[model samples]
Target: MKKILIVEDEKDLAENLRDLLEALGYVVVKVFDQAQFVLEYLKTEAVDLILMDVMIKGSMDGIKLTEEIKKSHPIPVVFITAFSDQGVLERISKGKYEGYLLKPFSLQALKSAVFLALNKHAILEKDLEGASKNSLKIRDKGYVVPVSQDDILFVEADGLYSKIVTIQKTYVLRGILKEISKNLDPKKFVRVHKSFTININQVTSLNAKELVIGEHIIPIRRGFYKSLLGLIKLN
Candidate 1:
């Protein structure tokens, strides 16, 4: 069962929602009217979903609270608002909620929206885990090989596959260059060429046209040269 937090100013409506969620085999962790209280509670509590009201009787609105929560950690938020004005809709869109429901929503709609939000949130977490470079698992032949971030020398793009070059050997994996580049640690890996992402720690020499990492000579595109040089110089 997933835990849910309800942030609504209307006490009667909050109770109704709690009862509905409880009946649907979901846990209602807390019903908070103010944003600060919710934030304070979350310091020690874990919740899977948040049902938030767009307008609340407090200093901080639901959108602002969600923004603050996202900076530290991301939780699926579903906005429930009575206001149907253009301004309210605009604010809801800016919040980027997984789902939204108008006032006096049906039980079926609420259930579907909540289920979709939770399912999507789970998928997002799996994608983040896959993209993270902290002890990445790469499929090498028939074995799943674990590679540390510090062990990588550079990544070179082959037509549709990517080559992970280490001090020992090179491994070919099925992935695009651009997607592979985004998964690497930005501080350690720098894209000198359109088809190559070089580990700064492995780079021994650099110039306007190319950069040398160990024995490999990687070409640096003219478009990426100036900005890359400037960024390195500033650092």
Candidate 2:
């Protein structure tokens, strides 16, 4: 199920919204009169979207909170309000909200807004994943080579640099394994060990402790053994 965080000051309305969204099959976490608390939860909790109210009783208004959240979180936000003044619309637009619902909105309107926002978020995420999978450029004034994720059979960390092994070629990079792992698609690539990140699709065979790709052997860390199997099956 997709998780959502609802931030509104009105208690009765918030409860009603929670029930309505829950009935629509969305897991909703509602916050009343506390934008700061919602912001903190967003840092650690996994939420797919946010429902924000413009006017609220808090240290920071909803507009500020929305701006801050958008900078760091990948989740989409929908602004809900009964007031439809020009200034409010300007502020909401400035936040780049996925959708906006004027006050006294119907249940159907709310449902439709949430549905479209989620669809847009999904599209954006897929585009980002595709872009990351297609290219990995050097981060610094080093030999910047664009390595296709498909061409990379595996990556082995050598100090601060990683040695990328492909089906027909190999290259060295001046970044750590964790740094490279961020740009790799989780569906296709996985970190099998602290020192190695392997493309699960390229893996020819796997043992209890090592993955065999042609003549090369990549060690699978004890803690990541189950995850490795999951990735292999996923790919």
Q: Please give the clash total of every predicted structure, in order.
A: 0, 2
How accurate locally is residue 207 in candidate 1, as Cα lDDT from 0 to 100? 84
lDDT of 1: 0.86
lDDT of 2 at 73: 83
Candidate 1 per-residue C-alpha lDDT over 1-235 given as tens digits, one digit per residue, 9 for 90 to 100: 9999999999999999999999999999999998899899988989999999888778999888888887776889999998899987887787667889999999999999999999999999998776564655688878888787677889999989999998888889889889888878888888777789878777677788987778988899887777766555321
lDDT of each: 0.86, 0.83
The alpha-carbon lDDT assigned to residue 55 of candidate 1 equals 80
Give per-residue CA lDDT, model 2, range 1-235, as digits (tens): 9888888999999999999999999998656567778877877787888888888887888888888888778778998887788998887777667988888899999999999999998998899777765877643345456667888888899999998888777787778899978878788888888898888888887877888876889898886666677667532
Best by lDDT: 1
> What are the TM-scores, per candidate, against the unseen true structure?
0.61, 0.61
Clashes of 1: 0
Off by over 4 Å in 1: 133-235
